[model samples]
Target: MTETPQRPLRVLAAMSGGVDSAVAAARAAEAGHDVTGVHLALSANPQSFRTGARGCCTIEDSRDARRAADVIGIPFYVWDLADRFREDVVEDFIAEYEAGRTPNPCLRCNEKIKFAALLDKALALGFDAVCTGHYAKVVVGEDGNRELHRASDMAKDQSYVLGVLDEKQLAHALFPLGDTVTTKDEIRAEAERRGLAVARKPDSHDICFIADGDTQGFLAGRLGKAEGDIVDESGTRLGTHEGAYGFTIGQRKGLRIGTPAPDGKPRYVLDISPVTNTVTVGPAAALDVVGLTAIKPRWCGTAPTGPGTYTAQLRAHGGETEATAEPVDGELRVTFTEPVRGVAPGQAIVLYDGTRVVGSATIATTTRATAGAL
Candidate 1:
C-alpha cells in the first residue's frame, strides 16, 4: 500500500468552506496527523464576512467546514483576525492607491496572515505545520532545498498568486490539494461523491475581501474622491478624471472622457499622480513597457548574495520572462528580456529559475527595464 506524507504531529488546516480546503483537511486527517480546522476571521464583520467566505464561507460555509471537520473527526475553531486583516491586507491595499501605485492585498494577506500571523499562532498552539488549498507543488530538492513548482494541473496552478512565499514559509506550509486533486472541478466531484454538503458551492471571484470587484467604489468610499486631469504623452489635457487612485495601468474603460483618441484608437491609463490628482491617458501602445523597478524584494529561498540572472514573472499566471536581478537597498532592479506592457506599481514581480523561486518584489515603478544587461 502507498504511504501518505508524514504529517508533522499536528496541523492547522485553513478552512474557508471550499471543497478544496475541505478535501485538504480530510487528506491531512487521512494521512494520520492530529488536525484542527481553523477559519481565519479576516473580515471586520464575521456575520457578514463573504470575501473568503464567498467562495463558500457563508453561514452555510462555516457550517460546511464544521460539518467536514465532524466527518473527519477533528477539532475546529475560528480565529478572529479582523483587525490585523484590515491593517495588513485592507489598509495596505488602500495605501497603495493613495501613493498612486497598485497593490496585491491577496499576496500581502498570504504573507502577513496565512503564513506569518496564523503560522505563528499555530506554532504557539503546538501545531507542526499549516495547511491550505492552494494549487501549487512544494518539493524538497536533492540538496535539501525547498521550492514551489507549478501544479501538476496547469489550469489550476496558483504558483503565480503564491509567488510571494519564501522557502521558510513554504517549509511550514502544505498544499494538500496541489497534486492529489488536479482541479477544483475534480475536488468538488469528490466531495459530492463522499456525500459532503459543500459539493456544489460556486467559486469566488474578484478580490475576496472586497464585495464584488468594485475596487473604484470601495476606494472612493474610504479615501473620498479627488478631481484630476487626464493627459496624453505630449502633456495635452485630454480630459478630467475622478481621481488617480481609481485607475490602474492597462485599464481601457471607465475614463468617462468626452473625446476619443486622435488616431481613432482606444485610450488606456498610462500614469497616475496622487499629488496632482492627475491621471495620464494615451494610446494602448503607451502602456506597453519593457522594464520596471520593484520594492520590498523577497527571495523564495535565501536570496543570492549578489547580482544574478533569473526568470521573472510580472503578474500571477502571466508568462515568464528572462531578466537579470540585483538587490539595491530594499528594492530590486530587474531588466527584462523584452519590453513588457502594462507594468504597474503595487503589483508583485516574482523571480524564478527553473522550478525554484529566486526572489520577488512589489513593483513600485517601471521605466521599461529592458535596457539593462541580462
Candidate 2:
C-alpha cells in the first residue's frame, strides 16, 4: 500500500524581493507548505531603483518578488501597506528623532507592522503563520509555549530587532533562514539554483523612506528649518546649528564649530535637548552609562521571577555586556557590570539569557557617574 503525502501548511510568506526573502519563500514551498508570497508595497511613491542602493519597495523590487514567487511555484500578491507603514514606521521615526531620541525603525516595523499588522491579517484570513527571512528562530518548549531564540548563524543573528515580539507573535511566526548554520551567500546561491530573479538583488540598508540615505535632509524637508545653538556641557556657546534633530548621541563630526575646545581635544555630542533645542558637545567620557531605565518592557515568554544577571545589548550589531536587570513597577532597570557608552534613549535594550531572548524594552533614561563621585 502506498503512503499518503503529508498535508501542507497554509503559510503566508513575506517576500521582500531580496535574496534572503526569495530563498525563504522557496524553502517554504519546497517543504510542501501551501505558501503564498506577498510583497508589501511600503512606499507611496516607489521608483524603479532607489538612491544609493539603500532603499526598497520600488516597482522593480515588487516585480522581482512576483517573479521569485512564480519560480517557487506559489501564488504572489502585493499588499498595499503604504499608509500603515507611513503612520507606524515613518511618522513614528520622525517623531522620535524630533524628540531628540534615537529610534530603530526596523525594530518598530517588525513590532508594529510585520508581526503585528501582517500577522493579524494573516490570522484573520485563515493562514497558519506569517513566514519571513529574518535570521531568528522560534522554538516550542516542552510545555508547548513558543520561544524566540537567536539564529544559528551568529554573524547574521537578528534576534536583537525581533526582541519586541511577544509570545503570541512568535507563535504565528516562521523563519526559514534561522534553522540553518549557513552564510547569506549560500542562500543567494540557492535562490540562483532555483531560477529566482532576485538571486543577486542588493541588500536593503539604511532607512527605507530616506532614499538617498540623507536622513537630515529628509527630516528637514518634512520639518522646516529651525536654528539652534551648539553649546558645550557647561552651557557655553560654541557655535550655531541649523537643527538639533540632525544630531545624535556620540556624534563627533559635522558639528560645524569654528572654535575648538581649550584642550584642543575632539568633542562628541553628549546630549540633545529638544526642549531648549540645544545640542550639547562634551568629552567622550560623558557618553558612558552606568545604568539605564526602560519602560513598557515586553517579555518574550514569562517575566523574570526575580532580579538576575542578563546580557544586554544597547544597539543593533552592538556589543553586549553582562548586566543586572530588575523589574520595577512594570519597568526594567539594568545596571551594567561594566559601563557602556553611546546608549541612547528610545533605543531598545534587548536582554538575553545565554542564547535565548529573554525580553526587551525601550530605554527611558541613562545614569552617568558624576565627575566628583568618581
Candidate 3:
C-alpha cells in the first residue's frame, strides 16, 4: 500500500502554553503540514507562577509550551517579543488613557504583535501561514478572497477582537480552533487524550503585561497624580478625583461624589476630558448615543460598496446593533438604528454583514439628538 503524501505547506503555530493552543498545534501537525511551534514571550519580567490566570506570558507558560511541543513531537522556539509588546501594546495603552481614550490592549496585541510582527517574520522565513488558537473563522469566498467570520460557538467567539486584521493578513492566517464546532471543554479533552500536561491549565483572563488585574492602579502608577474635577453635563462641579484618565465612559462607581443626583438615580460617566482634566457624570439617558464617527477603517475584504446597513458590534463583549455604515473619505459614519449606550472613544466598532466581518474602525466621536456629546 502506498502512503498518503503530505501537503507542501510550512506553518508556524503561535502557542500560548494553554490547552487550546496545544490542541491547535497538534491539529496542524495532524493535517500533514510541516508545523513549527512558536511561543511569544510578551512579558519583560515574567512571574514564576501565574496566579489565578492573571498573566499568560509567565515563565511557566513558556515551559508548558515546550513540553506540549515535545508531546506532539514538534520543534519549538520562544521568541522574545518583550520590547515590541512594550512599545506597541503597553505604551500605546498608557498613551491612550492619558489622551482620555479607552483602548483594548488585546486588540492592539493582535494588530501589532501576533498578526503584524509574527506574520511578517513567518513570511520572511518561508512559512506559508501563521496559525493560532483564536476562536474566529477565516473563510475563502467564491471570488477566492478571504473573509473573517465568527466562530461556531457564539459564547467563545473572538472575531470582534480580531477585527483589525486586514484581508492581506487574513490571507496567511490559520485558526484551528475556529474550524471546530466544539467547546473549550472538548478542546481540553482532546489535549488530555494526547497526554499533554497543559490540558488542565487555567486559561489566562487578564492582560498579559498586568501581573494584577487592577487596571486603575496599574495606570495610576504609570500616569502619576493629576488632580481633576468631577462635573455634571452642564459643567457643574459635583466632586473631585485623583485623575481624569482613570475614569472611562459608562463607569458608575468610585466617582467620589459627595451628593447624589436630584432624582437619586445612578449616574454614569459620560466623558473624560484630558485637556480640562474633568470627568463628566450624567444620567443613563445621556449615555445613549445615536451615531458615531469611526476612523482608520480596516476591512477583511473589500469594504461594502458605498453606504449600506451592517451589524455593528461596539465592543468586544457587547451585543450587535443594527447600523448604517457609510464610508466618508477614509473614515466611516455609523448611525445606529436604535440608540446605543457606552460608545466610548478608541474602542473598536466591528461591522458585519451577516456572519462575515465587513470591517472595523476606532470610534472617534459619538453623538445623539440635541447634539449630546461624548
Candidate 4:
C-alpha cells in the first residue's frame, strides 16, 4: 500500500467537466496512471444541469470532461447515476426537510454516490483508486488508517463536501487538485488555453438538485402542500406558514407574519417542529447555541476516544470555533469553547484537528450546556 502503490496506477477520474477534474485527468495520465474519465449523469435532479467549468454536474461540464479525456488519450464514459442520486441524495434531502431539519445534499451525494457507490465500482473494476477534483488530501497513516486533510488551496478547499467520506473511501481516493496553483480564475485560464468549451461559462451557484434555489417552491412542488402554524417557543400561535418544511433555523426573511413584534425587530426562525407542525420564531439571538449532539458520526480516519478538542466549523465559510468533543452516550458532545451564533440544526459541523479533518456529522440539535446557551 506504500511506495506510491505502483506506476500506471489504474486511476479513474470522476470527471465533472470542470477545470479542476479536467486538469486532474490530464495530470494523472501524464503521471503514467492508466487514466480514464467517468461522468455521472445526475438527470434525476430536477434542476437545469447546465453546469459550467466551475460547477460539478452539468451537461456542458460532462462534455468538457469527455474532451479532457480525449486530450489526455483515455477512454471516457458516462454512467447513469440518476437513480442512485434520487434515492440517496434527493430523497434524503426531501426527508430531511420534511423532518424540519436542514441538510447538506452535497455531503449526502459524496457519502452515497462518489465515495460509496463510485468507490465500490472502482474496486470491483480493479482500479487502484478513484480520483476527483475535490480540494482535499487523503493521507494513509502508518497504522493503515486513511486521514482527510484540507487542501493547500484554502479558498477552493472542498473539505466540507467531503466530510462524509470515511477512512475506507479516503484510502482508495485520490485528489489531484489537493496541491495546486489552480485557482478558479487560473483553472478557467488553463481551460481556455486548452480550448475547452466550458472555460467561458459562468459557474453554478446555490443548490444544483433544486432548480432556481427556490427551496420552498421545490418542497411545495414535491412534498405536497401542507399548511402549518408558526408559533412562538411557548406554543402560542403567532402566524401560519405554507409548510413546516419550508422554514429553517436562523432564517429571518420571508416569514410573512403580518403582525410585528413589540420590539419591532424582525423575528428569526429559531426552529421547526415537524411532529407538532409548527415553526418557532424569536429574536435573532435565540438561534445562538452553546453545543450540539451528533449521532452516527463519520471520522475521516478513525474516531478518537478522548476529551480532545478541535476546530469545529459550522458552515463552509464559517470561521473556526474551538470545541471539546467526546463520545458520550453514543453521541458526539460538542461543547463550543466560545458561544457560537446561528448553530442551525440539520447542518454539518465539520471537526478538524489542525489541517487534518477529524470527522463531520449532520447537526441533529443543540442544547444549552451547563454554561448556558450561547
In model 1, the runs with Cα more than 4 Å from the true position are 1-8, 51-53, 56-58, 369-374
Best lDDT among the predictions, by candidate number:
3
lDDT of 2 by residue, 64-176 (tens): 88888888889999998989998999999999989999999999999988998899999999998888989988887677678888888999999999999998888778888
Q: Global lDDT for candidate 4?
A: 0.78
TM-score of 4: 0.92
Rank order (by lDDT, best first): 3, 2, 4, 1
Q: What is the C-alpha lDDT profile of model 3 across 226-251, one tens digit per residue?
A: 88899888889999888888899999
lDDT per residue as tens, model 4, 187-216: 778777766655666665567776556889
Please list the residue runs of candidate 2 whose C-alpha ends up more than 4 Å from where it truly belongs after superposition.
1-8, 48-55, 370-374
Tell me which residue pairs clash in candidate 4.
none
Candidate 3 stretches greater than 4 Å from native: 1-8, 48-55, 369-374
Which of 1 and 2 is ahead in lDDT?
Answer: 2
lDDT: worst 10-residue window of model 2 = 1-10
In order of TM-score, best first, we have 3, 2, 1, 4
Error of 3 at 17 (Å): 1.2
Candidate 2 vs candidate 4: the TM-score winner is 2
Tens digit per residue, CA lDDT, model 1, 1-374: 11224445688999888778888888778778788998876765655445443653355567778887787788999788889888998898999898988887778888899888999999888888898888877887776777787677867777777877888787778887776536677888878776677778777656766665688988998899888789876678988877789999888889888877778888888878888888887776666566678878877777777778878777776887888888877778877777777778889998877756676788877874323211
- Which has the better lDDT: candidate 2, or candidate 3? 3
Model 4 spans with C-alpha error above 4 angstroms = 1-7, 44-54, 142-144, 369-374
